[model samples]
Target: MSQSEQPWWRGAVLYQIYPRSYLDTNGDGIGDLSGITRKLDYIASLGVDGIWISPFFASPMKDFGYDVSDYCAVDPVFGTLEDFDQLLDRAHGYGLKVIIDQVYAHTSDAHAWFEESRQSRDNPRADWYVWQDPKADGTPPNNWQAVFGGAAWTWDARRQQYFMHNFLPEQPQLNVHNPEVQDALLATARFWLDRGVDGFRLDAINFAMHDRAFRDNPPWDPAGRTITRPFDLQRRVYNQSQPEVPEFLERVRRLTDEYGDRYTVAEVASDDPLPTMRAYTKGDERLTAAYSFDFLYASTLTAGRVRRSQGNWIGPLEEGWPSWEFSNHDAPRCVSRWYDGPDRPRFAKLMNALLLCLRGNPILYQGEELGLTQVDVPFEALQDPEAIANWPRTLGRDGARTPMPWEEAGPNAGFSSGKPWLPVGPDHPGLSVGVQEQDLDSVLNFTRKLLTVRRGSPALKWGELSFLDVPESLLAMTRTCEEESLTCLFNLGAEPVEIPEPVNLGGAVLSQSEGLIDREGRIMPPYAFVILRD
Candidate 1:
């Protein structure tokens, strides 16, 4: 199919906005729908096709916005439903699709459904959540551990039973296997679709269901990996990624299909996520795309790693499209995770070019275009539950969730007139949008140019990726679409490497590096990349 005839999201770029950190227009130190509306122009200027706003639903601030208290109401902190409508309208006005998050796996303990479910054993909503009776020994239903820490099942005195939670105790797991629960979740989707949302990013959909038998999760070997929490020691077979999860997704797909061209992407995170990701998006009956933790949590970015990750999705179209992200609200920034050198600007540009040239859709986190690195959030000010639970061992996600720095000089780098909920990175002022807007050579400007180039090229936007035979330190590939082709080369190592013979380097459409390229096969500088028209 031609690029113009393909689905709008097949190879489109999405910008992820963490609502709490994007911009706080209310001076309450938190970003709201109105704040996002105010920044629509800036996001549209990034050349991304859509904006994936993290949860701004009715949340109780536990686990931030991930724990939804009400599926159909906007949290008072994020303004009213009218504010979201205005934001969505403004985003569409700027030609940007707005995709909101749907946390179907669980809801805040404060949610009316969960509250009613936990009230009594015989309540009308007793079975609305995953409630189970304790064993004769008074232990949890089984050996399941929460993602944050401790036992996954928490005791409830009222019901005298235990409730399961994949992440936090305050966020109880929902009984999505129940048809009624599925109907309610689908109704929530219909509510947003009725509100004119372009799509939904399903949060941890793999954890929506559990083993009905409540079997014990098999033990997992650390295999030279650090053991942070008890949850890390289990293979996580029984607790999540159940066989029935995809069946629920089929219903979600059918509902979304009712709304034309509506996109649905699921966040599938587990020990082995590729298979589940594929299953969740295998055909038109499931999700449009799914992204895993392959690149999100990687400590290093290498040619072989990228090859393996991309190779999985390079088969037939029925295998489904994948979405790649180098940074997001859940993990540390990529530039800081992958590179630890003095010349971060050059490395940032190289990574940007590499991401945009990949085979599938690319999701860019806010402030990524400006080369923002992870901040160092102190323990006293730590806001993330996982970070506080596993402190001093993990770098924690708070660093990446810091507020975006808009101006060089401001109360909180222009993120808010008052103190930001999270501190802006100390070094982010130098990389602020105001600073980079004037510099043509800045990473921000380079990102704009790179995006424009990708959008204009059919091969780069909707192409088949084939890795070239190159050294381990180098990643060379070609994105071919019908008659158009482009060669993408990246030096993923510290030392320079030579470009092999027979690889075309004549038409250098875009290049980033401190080294030179010549006709006789020149040495590519450390972290350099070039995109050539073939």
Candidate 2:
């Protein structure tokens, strides 16, 4: 199918499920593929168009499932290959497209390719991974730093040389510069395509290629110079985002094209993402869509910030599509990050409207529909290695990975009768899906209503966006198409903000926690949003 004909990803709502923490079926305390197959109906009930399941491939679990030991096989912890087939069958039966995570940039050191590459310098697979020579002073070949901290190069005594790893030491970077390596990775993707996956969420795609010249990177010295994590210390110029990275992406796009309607969303993270996104998805032959961490790490969600961020990539959006996500497995949950007042419910509803109203594919993280708050996990209860290494300074991601709460009164919130790998928070029971499903004003119900609104309007899905006169804490915009035109307004602050008479609607289409009825035509209630249509 041609780009114009593909509708699977356009305006799609993707619900991300972290398979390890989603549900546990057996007494093993970990979520498996079988557990996910059983929950397909629950996920479908969210009104999302598709699902993006995190890595469940064979791995040693060093960095969870990101370190793939075998790209084609399912881990016993997740289930066998047959169990995955059953999952694809069931997800399709519910009319939900399934997109799985593809970690092609690197593989676990335990992988056969890496093992053979490290065995000797002249081996057939020696060039499979990035091998570097040390400088005369016995330093690393380049100044690149690992994302998990320390130098990016690790010395291997067997080969009498150093190899590069952008993430954990156990996860070695593949030399995507090699045509054979690229072909092998493409083959792995083809294996999954044949197995019936709709598409892929490419993990850390920018890290696939590195600077061939092995040049040192310039140092990054911010004014505050405070180090949140070791990875933030230096500017990652040579370590990733090579000019040749897009060529490989184009090749992957061609491979996906062979399997009609199979889309690819490159997960891009860099010191600068606007130009990188433009370069990666600049033409018709590259990835179908891509996403970056612009809003995921923001300290505030003000209207001005949102406009500026959106404005950065809107120009190059014609080159390819853009995917927007407020929260995911790697970042803190949106509800907890954006909340500051007593009216968290109102805050969640407002934010939900803001997210879905944006002009891109909006990815809703699991448990988000239930208004789940971030869990306060004690140091002893922490399971994330990154958190354990850098305690008290960095807030670990464990708080966001807690098991889903399905019932209000059952043990483990009905996630599992067995002990969960990650402890469920005591406060989660009240926010369980079972309890919220019946409530008319619950977050889940509001999510359904919002999705229904989104589905009913093409302007919210594929219309052109134009920003209006937005005040300090107010956001107003218009989305228009050939058939319909609509205006959206939101007051993001705690105090009510006034606006001029909106474009059309006699009254507000959707209001916030408080109503807006006034003689002056000003909207009432802080953090309230409304849609006006002609």
Candidate 3:
């Protein structure tokens, strides 16, 4: 693809910033917009095209910023609207695009729309939220379960009906089936677009619409699953992934198109997100792209797993672009989750190289560049309701959402003057940004090199991807474009492996390493990776 014809978002690298844990200003012990603005240069140094700021909208913090109370206002804890404007301006000056989280699936129960909808039955917004009457036995309208736990339907004395909430009762599902509701959502999108946001990372978009009939979801066999909550007991057929979701996305596309060059990506969560992802992004009239929990929740990352995901969309003319992320605010750090012991550091760099080498847009979590490991938050220190509800079995998200370490040692590891909302682990001080920023051999530098290499190569940016049929534990893929053809390989294991003769590693090691290739065969260390030109 040529420069003129290339879409800004195609094969882009998005760095996700969980605003609450990124950095803190004003000694609030929590990260805020000003803190983000203070670190804009640090993020720009990472060579990412954009920053995806997780919800900073007004909220009660029931599910962090995911439960938005006001769509247009920035939460006081994050900063005022003026603060956001300053951040946006500073980011643009650094040639960075700003993408924000848009929680369209639901809203904080305290939202005026939901508040008014819960009043009288004849109100103008009475049907704005999903409200239903209880069954004959006064039980919930259906067997659908909330993602955080308990029944999806919450009993509300107001209007004498039960309101539906897919995650927490504090976040009631919006009745997107209503035309007025869709119009209101579009208005919110417009509010952000007009405020200078480049685009949005739609959170749980598959849950944006629900079955109009409010039908009971069927139970699924939990034979091989680790069922943590009641939600895992049923196949989420009726509650979400509705067929009408694509039509709604088309409307969103139209709204964004009017604003010019706006990008959209859907976060589809399900056992099988391929169908929804494919359908939602099947055409330009719908979403520009969509990503699921393919690598986020996986027990392992193997050759087959990578191949299957990349194979889902193949060649230069594939229907839609793909996006990938190894870890985020919601899941355990990939290095800690996939490997441990002395090999952890090696595995970290290996995975970073592998993720960047793949055929899709990549999302880098805030602390990931520094190879920050997950910090375990004790039961008493836990802030995530999902973790508090499920405890040890779930391995809660609190560990992953710990504050980013910016200094080797100080109050909150230089993250703040006050104590952080989440603990700054003892292990993180050494891996802090200040400590690694100057070290050429640090994971931070290595990751930056990988991103530099990716950005400089057209084949890596916009190329046709095809997996090589190779030996076990050895994953290899070829990326070809009009200008160049490249091969990428990885040793996703704990032991050394011998590379065969035909596995040609022509020249250069983007990731610094010793003894990468030999005449006999390249002896790969555990978690070793390399990129070569054809």
Q: For residues 55-154, could you state the per-residue lDDT of candidate 1 as single tens digits? A: 9888888889899999999998888999999998999999999999999999999999988998898888889899899999998989999988999999
TM-scores, all models, native as reference: 0.98, 0.96, 0.98
Task: Point out the higher-scoring one by lDDT: 1 or 3.
Answer: 1
For candidate 3, the TM-score is 0.98
Model 3, residue 124: what's the lDDT? 99
Regions of model 3 farther than 4 Å from truth: 315-318, 512-515
Q: Which residue ranges in model 2 land beyond 4 Å of their true spot? A: 1-6, 313-317, 502-514, 517-520
Q: In lDDT terms, how accurate is model 1?
A: 0.89
Candidate 1 residue 85 Cα shift, in angstroms, is 0.5
Order of quality (lDDT):
1, 3, 2
RMSD for each of the candidates: 1.1, 2.1, 1.3
Best of the two (2, 3) by TM-score: 3
